[model samples]
Target: MTQKYRNYDPEFKLYVVKLMELDGHKMTDLSQKLDIPYGNLKRWKTEYRDQKKKEEKEAQNQLLTASEYKEMYEKEKKSNVELQEEVDILKKAMHIFNQEK
Candidate 1:
């Protein structure tokens, strides 16, 4: 049985594959040279392809209507401002009450 080397990160393994591709090296030669299993390279390549497809689909998904988005943002801004004002009022009340001590 072939001896195993230290475990490498999956990300690093993928990076190795990318670099090998860019270098115009043959996959068979790389598999032999890098001591990585051919199956791992094929699986990683497939996973990368599928992930890219999913990302593209998500990016092309429809966004909310401009008016609806604007309305939601304004509501959130108003709520935040109201909360800040209430906090300021409570602080002032506490300061005044403390001064009577």
Candidate 2:
């Protein structure tokens, strides 16, 4: 007899993890009730938690990048406005000196 293996989809694995979390289901009971191996359930739970942590970390990094870009943009905008004002002042001064000459 050939040993057959069952492949589970991502959705079903996620659902099992959610059931464990939401219902406070014990691993042994869940394994028996769901007709899944205890080791598979444990592995799935670990993978799910790790995946969530990774997603959270990625989100934080993206937010930090966006905020850094915004801060740099604000600084550049302020610097440009100040430089424009200086240029206007210099032009006026030059005009007045030419009129005096």
What does candidate 1's lDDT look like per residue over 1-101, in tens digits? 99675576988877876765567676678778888887777776677678879998888675678898999999999999999999999999999999999
lDDT of 2 by residue, 1-101 (tens): 99668999999998989989888889899899988999999999999899999999989877757788899999999999999999999999999999998
lDDT of each: 0.81, 0.92
Give lDDT for model 2. 0.92
lDDT of 2 at 7: 99
The TM-score that candidate 1 achieves is 0.55
Best by lDDT: 2
lDDT of 1: 0.81
Cα distance off (Å), candidate 2, residue 89: 28
Off by over 4 Å in 2: 65-101
